[model samples]
Target: MTRFNALLLALLAVAVPLSLLAGRVWIDPFDPQLPNAAVIFIELRLPRAVLALVLGAGLGTAGAAMQGYLRNPLADPGLFGIAPGAALGAVLSFWTGWAASGWALPLFALIGAGGAMALLGLIAGRGGGVLLFTLAGMMIASLAGALMSLAISLSPTPFAMSEIVTWLMGALADRGWAEVWIAAPLTALGLAVLGLAGRSLDALSLGDLAARSLGVDPRRLQALMIAGIGLTVGASVAVAGIIGFVGLMVPHFVRPHTDGRPSALIVPSALAGALLLLVADCLCRVLPLQGELRLGIALSLLGAPFFLALLLRLKRELA
Candidate 1:
């Protein structure tokens, strides 16, 4: 398993740069204006590929952390309310014309995600148990989702509706280095926090009581994990506007190579996530559909059944 993980990581490292180059070369195929392609490469495809890699790594690592902390294999940042909350924030910002220019949407999204985490923290009722906390996560997500739906329903302008729907579905089409610059630092910080807490996550797998018995402070670790996941997913949702299932799916795919161990989960998951998103984005470009395929739609088509299988497996384990 370790060997497999190592090989996977190496392949991903090589593939990311190659994928960027491949995407650039493929963008305007059969064009006689090959000499002017440098501007296109520098201005468009390069940034898009970088965004995919960053978003994928952030989602993958955060998903691993969420699952570890909650002791639930099916956990995702969106399931815990962050994505919907962020979406509401972004869409509302756009709807109100408050952040009509630049990256104001993503900034508001981060604020919305933070607000959701804060609300959940308060709802957990001053150090609530795991089940109570998890329920709070669900409640907040549901509430945010409802609000987002209402906003969309009430939107009168076609342009606004189009923008809202496009972002919600998640696409890397027009993003550039500016978006990359905004997301990169936040992702790096989130990864650092996750790395620091890896041992704690490993302890958590043995159950709360056992973890405490072994000198692990489960509650504190859980708090840190939530903060980490919130920040990471918030940043991602800010930029990508809710690319789902990468979080849930990438970790599951990588778990085998890590032997189901949390301590070894982060890096492998990050690599697999980069691989998944790159391939997904590539497929989006090549699909025969009239409109561009959205990342969220692609992930849903690929991940929904996998999520169901995971649920069945969990039920079996519980039984």
Candidate 2:
């Protein structure tokens, strides 16, 4: 695990510089003639890359933890509905023309996440099993998605509707230090929460009854999962607008290299996710098109095929 983590760290070190240099107007770092190169690196590309690492790490960690808690390979952080809840909040901000305020959008989104978390707790209730918790999450996700759609349809102006739609597609474009500040601390705290739950998740792999016999507290573990995933996914959505697939896809990439323990998988998944998102964002910037590709779209394009392949593999195994 140490070697694998070290390898990932080494790869991330290489990828970060490439991400900084790759864009429509590529920077020749060695050349002294380039104008405003420092500004571009510091102001434009740096924050975007940092935000990718932060959000990707959060998503990846959350994914590993979720899959472990559910004991299902297909589980994702977004399955908990936190991301959709945050998106609904952001959409509401746009709907009401409050997004123009610097902090209103993220603040609204966080409140929405809190509401979803509260609802999830209420619906799941104490002693609710994993199945019930999952169902409650699905319910919240459905309700949030419906609400977001309603907001878009009832938008006061076409411009507002357009803004909401575009934001939903997701991007790191035009993001700055403010986004980094908003997401980083929340993501870091989330990662810590998930780390503390690692042992419980490992016990959970032995089945709920077995986990209980082994001194695992189901309610405590559930709370940790909810809080960890809520902070990580909510913060990501608050900053990046609904970037998907990172949580769903990242764990699979790293699981093979680990000992198949959730605790073993989390850190490696985080590093790999950071590398993947950074490279993908760089690709979005460098692609020759009228406009840079949206980060969410690019990941979806990659993730859809990957998901299909995974399903086919599972079918063969089942067969």
Candidate 3:
């Protein structure tokens, strides 16, 4: 399984770069303008593709770690509430004119995300129980989402509303290398932490009691895992907004190939996630609309129905 995951990672590390270079003008059979082609490739397509790869890899790794720690295949990065928390932080920055000033929004968004995770951790660990910790994280997410909506409603500026809505939809359009540098290191760190914890997660699959008997401390590892996932998702969301379902969907794509093992699922999920987001971003470029579609909307428009069908199939299998 590990070998297979390593293979998938190697494949994607190559594919993402080639896909970043692919485009309409360069790939077209009869295109003639060579100098303009360089400008478009460097200024437009490359950045979008890089953003997609980073965002996808970050969310995918976070999702894999969350599912393993929670022992629920359906779990995602949103489980920790960082998405809405970051959105709200961004909204606050826009309303206060901070986002207009510079990169303050991303900075504030990270703070908001970290704060929300900290609150969840404190509440859940009040008595040192697993179920309560999971329950607390869910509650924090729901509450943060509601608060984000409330903040939007209460803001007086109409322009603020439009800006907030556009951001929440998620887009890689017009983003530059700065967004890449902002997100990539955090994603890399988060992935490294999860990779080191993979053996711990494998022990966790045997249930917490079984893990404790084997000398793995489930509680400590869970705390670390949740914090690591929070950082990855927070950093990604701070830059890209609430891109949904990648976390939910990527594990589903990787699990069948990995035979449902936590250790095997992490890296493959990252690779599959990078591939999925790059494809989605490319579709965003070629869509027949005047304005580009948000990656979140594109993903939801496509993934929602696929997920519904998947759910129905699962029910039938269970029966």
C-alpha positional error of residue 4 in candidate 3 after TM-score superposition, expressed in Å: 4.3
- Candidate 2 segments whose C-alpha is farther than 4 A from its true place: none
Best by TM-score: 2
Colliding pairs, model 1? none
Worst 10 residues of 2 by lDDT: 120-129
Order by TM-score, highest first? 2, 1, 3
* Error in Å for residue 84 of model 2: 0.5
Q: What are the per-residue Cα lDDT tens digits for candidate 1 across 73-137?
A: 88886777877888889989878876578878988998998898888778875553678888888
User: lDDT tens string, model 3, 191-262?
Assistant: 887787788788889888887787777667766776678777887888888888888888887888886778
Ranking by lDDT: 2, 1, 3
Tens digits of per-residue lDDT for model 2 on 78-113?
888899999999999999899999999999999888
Better of 1 and 2 by TM-score: 2
Residue 1's C-alpha lDDT in candidate 1? 57
Cα lDDT, model 3, residue 223? 68
